[model samples]
Target: MKFSKAEIDAVIAASPRTNLPLSKLVLSEERQVRPQGSTPKLSVAELAASIKDSGVLQNLIVVKGARGLYEVCAGGRRLEALTVLAQADDIPENYPVPVLIVPTDKALIASLAENVFHIPMHPADEYAAFARLIGAGKSVEDVAAAFGVTPLVVKRRMKLAAVSPRLMAQFREGQIGLDCLMVLASCDDHVRQEQVWNGMPSWNRRPAYLGQLLTQGEIESDTDPVARYVTLKAYEKAGGTLRRDLFSDDDKKAYLLDTALLESLATAKLQKKAQQIAAQGWKWVEVRARYVFEEFVKFGELRKTRRAPSGEEAAAIASLQSRLETLRARMDALQDHEGDDDNDDREFLKLDAEGEPLEAQLKALQESLCVWPPELMTQAGCVVFVGSKGTAEVKCGLVRPDDRNGVAEVARKASEVDGDGESLVSLPSAKTRPVHSEKLTRRLTAHRVAAVQAELTVRPDVALVALTAQLAHSIFRDDARGYHRPETVFAITAADCQSDLPTAAEDLQARILDVVTEAVDANAASPLAALKKADAANGAEQTVAATGWLPACLRTRREAGMATEETLQDAPERAASEALAA
Candidate 1:
């Protein structure tokens, strides 16, 4: 291990520097000791002249083998030169090239190390050497020091050695670079590593790009064999166009129009539209009124009417007659209550002023009913004729010839006066019928109930109350403007009333009154308006209470536990104190 230069020189001098005869040399057993560099072409004339003039300056390094044969380690070119000279009869045919005997393994290592120091070896040779060192149990540090590199570099070289033979062949053939191989080595997953290695186009594989590919899954991983195979096949079928159009402009458009994406957009749009419709219901009484009007139009046409109505119509007429009778009784009661004094007289006058319009309207209705013709009566059809006497009739089949003539005469008279009342006497087309209570009841089922409930859950305040009320008015009111049957309207009102005042009936009643008054002013249906106002009042109170500054008494009670009532009414407080003590 410590051989000096003199000792090495002495050994070299004693060792015969000659090539044994070709017949004696065991050519078949010769092993490649060192890889050859690219040989420069020399002309035969030049080679021959140089061989004759200078002979071979360097002796071939060989190890002694069996039967006096030699294995060439280095200086193969010099050996070849001598062989050529002998063939041309320029030198002795049996002449031998210089030979120095050493252990075969030592010669191989020395020759390789020497050549590696002087000139570059193929990557394959470097990888093999690293592998040999590792297999010999040499530490990475030892190998690094021997190769004049850091241990990291040694480790990288060792990794190259561990790479699959196929990949190594690629490296050796210069199909891939060391940088790319380093990338493959860094991969923790073997399958992923292999996939990345294989996926790389022969020209594009680079160490820097490998990190990106691994992080992004741009390159298929080898760890998941099945996934890797599937991905690889897909990639191949796609013509290996990776990373070329990954972030192209068209993908953004595709994402925008994707079915799931479009569905989400549509859902948002519908929700917004529904909210708008609900908000409109809250803002405009006319909208609800119009909806009710349309419903009534589907059932019956309004027309001026006279006497003889069916049993159902007669029942409705009787109800209206009773209401008018009650109004008359109230008016007579006001008359009798008058006093002799002047102030009392003035109060009576005010009462009379209010009663005049009521009396006129009732008297007019009475006269209209008294004069209404029986021939004008028919079943409910396009026109519902409500007699001023409170009877109802529908126009059945076609208009009678006499009734038609009468309507025409009325129209002609109204036209002569240029009166707008011409439309009132005209008969509507047949087919329309009064919307029956039973039909209205059938329409108000559990489906509507659920829809209203869902709406309240989203907006649980006055807005919901207003919306439900408007819906009630549409479904229940009796006038052509009121589509809802009375019963259905009552049911909805009850439910809403219950919702508004779940715990306090009196509070609910007050809120309803307030809402109705406000609604009446807003031109909304009285019942619905009342509910909306009640909800608004409650909401306002809640808003004020939530945001208002605390009163001093309440603040003191909270902060100091001082009850205001304790100091007031000391006699009662003393009694309470004595009771507690007792």
Candidate 2:
């Protein structure tokens, strides 16, 4: 019975196998190679589940025990699992177990051999085997039950199995790793999988890149704003397709295929909301999937004015406010007394329930007082679009650039009227078009240009300064301003100007000239530019600005009155007698 290593293999080969009833088998003390309670409880539970699903698979090595019971020297865990199953009534008390009977002397050696020499199946092989079982007509749930794992685990393994054959071959050869294979498995198209793998450079074949490339052109249901707006269920209901990635932890990590459908749905919903707003008598209403600030910044927005609330509305607002205050006070008192006492807690909950609705009613009543005049609504427009957080957005009282002049005229008339009186001149509706045709516009601009050119010849200083500024702006502009062409005629450039001016001197000098010219002329430039430069000047700029002198081009206005000691003492009088005598 004390055999050398050479004889152990022959003994294993010659062992006799038989079935023994669970009631007649016992775990042997000789099988205590592993420390007592060393096995994890989860592993024991899984083993029990597996045994219950499809009786014990491998045979246990046993020896004759002290009475009629057979002692299991090897596979003590299997014995424990069978006992657990029998106790739980999952299996009958006398369920049969497979065993290999060995001599009493060799029982310890058999136990050691079973524990130490056994190698677990490779992970790749296990996944592949699961795929094969599924392919052999077994359901995912069935396979999971057989293996004592959840269906999700089985699904993940099956997803891995669905990888391109070429990639799988590379995985087996240890060329491609399991992580990269998982990403490839996320894409159901095998051709796409192989193409992605072959297209990637050797150094760039990573899981993250692989995942990104695989799901390119597909919208993510969870993270994408459009998809979140439309909702995954809505997209699917509209006959859209989704590609799932089982390896990802997020349950919503699926890609939506029909992006056009989502966009159409969003546009349609926006249009419906826009129609309701348009009924409020706006001149024009437009809808867009997204709101781009640059596209709409040039439009003028109407000023919002408030009207006094009516008598009934005012009374309701006061009542709601009072009720909200009372509810809050009561809730606060209840909170002060809240403790182990259930009555105080219940009262606090009841009072808290009334607070939100009353506050909401008061807020709604207050906001209802803000309104745009009916005349202004006719001049301005509205825009409806989707916001970045996937909700509908509305922008109202927007006046188009062409309509700003008309709207300003109406506002001026309104200001002149006293006590909400009607305007003396009737305002034109937004539907009115300009009376001048294209031909008339061309003729008018041509005449204006001729007069401007004639005036420019007499004012050489104005022409020179205009030419210099235009040339400087064109030469020293950033890439963001590259699209704007300088609207000037003289393209002056020479080494003489460059020699006279330092590279950095022109920028500061030009800005100073601009500020002085603007202050003298008092002509309003862009409102945005004025705001940006309002507080931008420092002490040096202020010192330069005190000169009060400007180039001829910017000094287009002429002052009729002179500021001298004589004029300060007495008002200047027009000499009318000389013309009357002629």
Candidate 3:
């Protein structure tokens, strides 16, 4: 049978009123005892304040007990707050606490209903509330205290509230996840936030991607080598600002915004470090943002041999060890009580910080005992750079090719006569070649080729054979350098082989500066300045086709060879020949 609307309403209200009428009764611990369950903890401070300001807003459900007492089956949190006020004498002992009297059997159902149906306010409401509180001139700390949450939490709410209203609405509608809202709220610009949202493809709207999108052009302070070298405070002092991630603990998400400032700071620090190294009597020092390990392999590193520590040094080390042991014992003992007391933890950390520098100093002193000879040090210098580990690294006693003084022949002579160190006397050599100075090499080769051409007429058979061989090679082989101009050739006789090519410049001048230096200083045409650097980039660049002027292959078969002017300068005799004669 169909029922009228009024009849339906009557049927609904006909049942016993579960929401009973509220009445005030004497407050007592013996009566209306609070129930227990695994429930979310209430903020007693906040609740207590509310109760003090306005007496209980909700009626506590109670059950009758023996001796005119009542047991609280529901609204335990309200009872707890009321109890706190009563204990503090803010409320009278027999304070009239408003409650709803119910039967004992139905108390469990009432308690479960009260707890299970209680839904927390949406996060959007929380954000709005926090925003309203802030707009009303309440500080972050004040709002935090009122809400019983951290200042960071209150700030986060305010930030979320500040995001684009559209995005916030989407978040409220459950269209946006917490992570999405959090990352989107990184920037204060609502317009930018909306732009990022619109620009982002639906498939890649992940939190990490959104965070990176928001923080583009910003360098993570912790990961930046410059920031690691210079503290964040120092960067600020040098005029840099950091954007901190509120969601991150301990401000670990700091990002350095002023890149130019960071670079300047890094350069200044590197220059200072370089000056300090140069003060150590190094001939030169270089400063670079990064030093590659590959470059170190190109240079010859002097082997370091340790000298025995003196009595004073040994005693100092022993004393430091004793102190370290004592400190370590104390630290271990303190570690047992760590976090028990703040002061104890501070002391433990302080000792820990102190121990590291001392240990480092000891290690450095021990390392210092090992020495490269002062002579070697004077001949060579070092390079200073910020390594990947965010510390200054000094590579010492690396001798440049130009720094090599004695000739191999002189060293060989000295070793034969007696096992003394290599004599510093210069000897003639043709090993060094001018790969970079192509024009200079061509000129030198031209002179030698002219001489060879004039001499070829007397040695007709050798000339004919050499011309035939050159033709065969030129026709058969695909040499990129083209046919070596026969006019520049310096022919060699099989009976008397020429060990040294005549076209080379002085032994030192023939040595090409590192092509790295050549490319870098190429415009300057001052290879001498870059002679100090042994760069791996130069080695890689040098791996090009071995193209150079060779006079032997460039000589021509000429008829009338003798020149009008025939004068020659006498060459110096070999030192070994002179020594044998004596």
Candidate 3 local lDDT, 448-536, one digit each (tens): 54544545666665466556555554455434433332322222221211223442233233343443233344443353444433432
lDDT, candidates in the order shown: 0.46, 0.71, 0.62
Q: Which segments of model 1 are wrong by more than 4 Å?
A: 1-121, 200-204, 215-582
lDDT of 1 by residue, 447-512 (tens): 334434555466545344455555654454345422222222211111221122122122233444
RMSD to the hidden true structure, all candidates: 34.5, 16.1, 19.7
Q: By descending TM-score, how would the candidates be arranged?
A: 2, 3, 1
Q: Estimate each model's TM-score.
A: 0.21, 0.62, 0.50
> In angstroms, how far off is 337's CA in candidate 1?
99
- Regions of candidate 2 where Cα sits further than 4 Å from its true position: 1-5, 36-55, 84-90, 165-180, 189-213, 250-253, 316-361, 418-582
Candidate 2 or 1, higher lDDT: 2
lDDT of 3: 0.62
Worst 10 residues of 1 by lDDT: 282-291
Name the Cα RMSD for model 2: 16.1
Ranking by lDDT: 2, 3, 1
